[model samples]
Target: MVTIDQANQDFAQKVQSMDGGETLMLCFQCGTCTASCPSGRLTAYKTRKLIRKAQLGLEDEVLSSPDLWMCTTCYSCMERCPRGVEIVDIITLLRNLAVEKGVMSAPHKKVGEMLVKFGATVPLNSEYEDKREALGLARKPANTLGDEKALADVKKILKATGFEDLVGGN
Candidate 1:
């Protein structure tokens, strides 16, 4: 049986393997992150639980948790962490790991595809265009769906980051 120290050491090693997860080990379990998280209050989300899972080397629990995806990148937890742990960065790392491990669903994968294809999560359909025009804004040019140069840059970054494989394609 593993001792508490041994378990903690193992968790530390696992967190260290992640790009931005090294800071997660510094958390003191003060519950500040959970109290500060906006999503935790609304949903069953709990940032503190995620930190505990990471601290215990509960890899499957951390990777497959919807709480990790619920974070809005709002940085509230990061700001509240007294140990200066990069809470948002840790969440992002968990999200990337989840996606890479195929724990995320097809709809989640499609969101990435949509972002790659349209440069936005929400497709700017004709109704949106009509609403923009009705609000007195000039109609965007037909070719203004997505900026070509920006899309190319995004594709290059995604390819370099192995995000294409994470989402299962371009």
Candidate 2:
């Protein structure tokens, strides 16, 4: 019962509109990206597989795959790509698409929530502050946590970018 109508024609076009997606179709499944991926070494992430899914325009599979967010955006794959494909950027675009579809994993959501609430993905703690002071560094380092204004601005930027809603931030 398979038919040509099953193809996701718009998926590639939609992804192409994003920054790194432009070179998506150039991938020939050389496995270079996967071979260069450090994350793929320790995790279930497979860069080549993701590129293949994207090339095939498997929108649902690409968007829902937890592997979409496994990319560290290191650009190692892009650098190693013989075809000069922007693999990291495409992965980032995939993450954005997944968020748009409200399919973020719990760890991603928690990190986003922490960023919105504390202006840092990893909130500063008194224990860490003590360690800093012990090391002759200021207990409160120069960052968003040290300045309420900076923290507010970070929240404002997140709101302006619509990332708050994307991460289900309250």
Candidate 3:
């Protein structure tokens, strides 16, 4: 349980003001999000815990905790929420907030780098390329790896949006 001090007042309100976060106040701690979270079943992540932290204004804990990044954004929680809270969107918004504030973790940073480089979070390897070639498909699949212009465009977009700075990769 996180304790909020006067210094952290209105943290919940701040989060609610964010896009896709407006319905955050609708959550009544029903625990449905937790019950429905696939990540929670496999990891230490508790969707309800994150929401509770946000609702209670535990800004520092909520932003800094790695659990904030555990959500796969599959939308199962949002689908099951009784209040129609956009749980997935809220989680994604929170993650964006966390990253913008330099609260990202190392693994996530690596994936961001891969996205910037390969235009996909999961990059390709020789094994997959060989398999694709064996199947008579374009070995590099016309994506960033196979297309120079597209890769340069991805790099350009990442740079223009400051995502490279945010995730610490070029």
Candidate 4:
């Protein structure tokens, strides 16, 4: 049911040109990646099918798929690939492309927002602080937790990458 106009003829080429995406065209649809995917066992995420879609230039379908975000990035598929395709990396690249287009799930947006505001995805909550203190560690790890300079640097990078705007963060 796919129409010709829906395909981006240069999609695969563009993927190949990106770092960590060089091995994309080497995929032969052996299904090894899909078979080895732990996420596929639980979710409807079929790595092989996604690769085929990319090969066939189904750009919109591939990028906008909710299944794209289901990968746990465990590298199980990459380890098992007979063709040595960087499946996880390709997924990451696709995710970046999707984000560039401002297509992202709510949870991912929330995480990005948290990163923008707090400079960390897991903010310094009381539960985490208590656990750290109990373990003889500083309540806030010496990272970007409450460090204004570090947080500002993170915001600068996010702003430079246009991620702050993508996630609706100031």
Candidate 5:
């Protein structure tokens, strides 16, 4: 039940002003994006409905929605859209906005924390290191995991992008 008073009115314009969100107002609600959404089949992610909510200025509802994070970004909806709407791009922008507002999901937050601490999403543990050694490979690959300077570089990049602040786990 979206009441008139709940509308921010400028939410749609803000979205439209975003780079990938230029096509925001072009949606005619044909439901094609929803029909073509793979995530919608397995989850409650209705791309069309979410776009409508954005158009209606339901900023809080749109940004805080778990469904907003459910997009696999496979571009299926964009491929099938009759209006050439950049649905996935808009979703990406929405996700960026959500993270900016500190509305990230727990699992995503954990991944961010891992990157901040380890410079990688999945740190190489002893078990995997042993397996790699047995296979005649280095315990850690030639990535941030294998190099302290590289890890420091990654942390620097994350900090520069404000990902550390958004993730919030030290």
Candidate 6:
């Protein structure tokens, strides 16, 4: 059986190599982040538990959890952490690890696909375009889909980072 000490040592070594994961060692498991997370209240997403799993080197558990994807990157947990553990940043790191392991699945991939194809996840229907015009914003050219340039840039970065496969290709 894997001992807690062994787990901690493994996790320490793994996370230490990550750029933004240095502060993970300081987490005291106070559960403040879990308590403050809006998604945790509404769903089964437990930020504290996820952190604990990561700390224990339960990489498979952390990588396979759908709860990791539910974080909206709201930064509420980061603000509430008493230990000053970069909660949101750690979550982002876990997500990147999961993507690297090819453990992340679809729906997430579909969202990326939509962003690459339409420049936004949601289509800019006539109503939203009209609303933008009504709000006195100069209407973009009708041919303009969305932030095509930005999306293209994002695709290039994702490909370089090996996220293209995580998002189910370009």
* Top lDDT hit: 5
lDDT value, residue 127 of candidate 6:
86
RMSD for each of the candidates: 3.9, 2.5, 1.7, 1.7, 2.1, 3.3
Give the lowest summed-lDDT range of ten residues in model 2: 1-10
- Model 6's number of clashes is 0
- The regions of model 4 sitting more than 4 angstroms off are 3-5
The residue pairs in collision within model 6 are none
Q: What's the true lDDT of residue 129 in model 2?
A: 96
Off by over 4 Å in 3: none
> What is the lDDT of every predicted structure here?
0.77, 0.85, 0.85, 0.90, 0.91, 0.77
lDDT of 1 by residue, 70-138 (tens): 888899889878999988888887777776677875677788887667656677778877988999975
TM-score of 6: 0.81
Once model 6 is optimally superposed onto the true structure by TM-score, how far is the C-alpha of residue 81 displaced, in angstroms? 0.7
Indicate which candidate wins on TM-score.
3
Using lDDT as the yardstick, the better of models 1 and 3 is 3
Cα-based TM-score, every candidate: 0.75, 0.87, 0.91, 0.90, 0.86, 0.81
Model 5 spans > 4 angstroms off: 126-137
**Clash statistics: count for each candidate:** 0, 0, 0, 0, 0, 0
Q: Which tens-of-lDDT digit does each residue in 5-65 have in candidate 5?
A: 8989999999999999999999999999899888899988899999999999999999999
Q: Mark the 10 consecutive residues where model 6 has the least summed lDDT.
A: 138-147
lDDT of 6 by residue, 78-98 (tens): 988888888788888888888
Worst 10 residues of 5 by lDDT: 161-170
User: Model 2, range 1-170, lDDT digits (tens) per residue?
Assistant: 32335558889888887777898888888998899899999899999988887877788888988898788788888899998888888888888888778788888889998988999988899999999999999988787988888988999999999988877775
Candidate 3's TM-score reads 0.91
Q: Which lDDT value does model 6 have at 169?
A: 71
TM-score between model 1 and native: 0.75
Clashing residue pairs in candidate 1 are none
**How far out, in Å, is residue 109 in model 5?**
1.1
lDDT of 4 by residue, 1-170 (tens): 77768999999999999998999999998999888888999999899999889888999999999988988889999999999899999999999999877788788889889999899998899998999999999888877895788888988999998888889975
Give lDDT: candidate 3, residue 129: 93
